[model samples]
Target: MKKSYRIKANKEFQHVFKHGKSFANRQLVLYYIKKPEQTHFRIGLSVGKKIGNAVTRNRIKRYLREAFHELEAGVEPGYDIVIIARQPTKRMNYHEMKKSLIHLLSKEKLLSKK
Candidate 1:
């Protein structure tokens, strides 16, 4: 993911967790806060050890990045978005993960009407 699009700071992640609205499913939890002052988005992903080893966790992040890339056009901008992978997410394939991500984002009304 591009540096501009990824949310890399601890403080930013905390801000999202503290202030964002959340939505979840078996595979993922999404937290999002709208930042009207901004013109773009910052996204973060969390795939902890509870889900898997480093390799497994990295795989999840990779898949999520790709999924987000694919859906980026449809997503509304100006939000800080965080995606935390759940235990079940460790075993899912890219398509499943993509679907889960979209579902969660859709629930947040983050996906555009198109």
Candidate 2:
């Protein structure tokens, strides 16, 4: 992920958690809030221990990050996005995960019309 697109600050995360609207599909939960900046969009991924071991958590995070990279070009500018992985993600392969992520983003109208 590029530095400009990364969600780096604690304040940003907290703002999203507190104010962003959320939607969930089978594999992931997405939270989004509009921000004033137009330069770039920021994204954060959360994978919890309740889902699995460290390996599984890391694997899920990696999958999510890759999926985000693929879809990043379609994302609208000036938003904060947070994706939280669910237990179902442990059983999903990369393609399935990617599809789910895209589906969720599309549902949220975050993805630009294509």
Among the numbered candidates, top TM-score falls to 1
lDDT at 89 for candidate 1?
A: 83
For candidate 2, lDDT tens digit of each residue in 1-114?
Answer: 887777768788889989999999978999899988666788898888999999999999899888878887898888989998998999999999999988998888999986
**Of the candidates shown, which would achieve the greatest lDDT relative to the real structure?**
1
Q: What TM-score, computed on C-alpha atoms, does each candidate reach?
A: 0.96, 0.92
Q: Write the per-residue lDDT of candidate 1 for residues 1-114, one digit (tens) a residue.
A: 678999989999999999889988988999999999978777899988888899999999999999988887888989999999999987899999999988988888899977
With a 3 Å backbone cut-off (N, CA, C), the pairs that clash in candidate 1 are none
lDDT of 2: 0.89
Model 2: number of backbone collisions? 0
Q: Report lDDT per candidate.
A: 0.90, 0.89
Alpha-carbon RMSD of each model: 0.8, 1.2
